[model samples]
Target: MKNASPAQMLLGLRIHAAAFVATIIVLFAVNVMVGPPYWVGWVLLGWCIGLISHWWSVRYHTSHRTDPN
Candidate 1:
């Protein structure tokens, strides 16, 4: 598949971040209801790493991109 444009990559990152936040909220609610070991923290940490990696990847690509002109 062709590579996405920088704008597309950024948009994808935003969508991923939004979904991550929404999912984390639901997970936190569930964890609270369960009243136990609180596993949502682990999920948040792991997903945060992934999200940061995604953001870094986008930033690197966009900053390094050469204009086609």
Candidate 2:
């Protein structure tokens, strides 16, 4: 795939973060209903790592981007 522009990368990161938050909310509700082990924390931890990585990638790309001019 062609490389994404910095704006596209940032947009993707935002979308990913929003999805993560939404999913975590649903998972937390399910965990509360289940009333036990509370696996939402684990899911949150794993997804957080991915989200941080996505953020770092966007930061790196945007900082390193070179102008075509």
TM-score, every prediction: 0.93, 0.93
Residue pairs that clash (backbone atoms under 3 angstroms), model 1: none
lDDT of 1 by residue, 1-69 (tens): 027898899999999999999999999999999999999999999999999999999998888887878
- For model 2, name the residue pairs that clash: none
| Residue 10 miss distance in model 1 (angstroms) | 0.7
Worst 10 residues of 1 by lDDT: 1-10
TM-score of 1: 0.93
Cα-based lDDT at residue 7, candidate 2: 78
lDDT per residue as tens, model 2, 9-32: 888999999999999999999999
Q: What does the lDDT come to for candidate 1?
A: 0.92
Q: Which stretches of candidate 1 lie over 4 Å from their true place?
A: none
Residue ranges of candidate 2 with Cα displaced over 4 Å: none
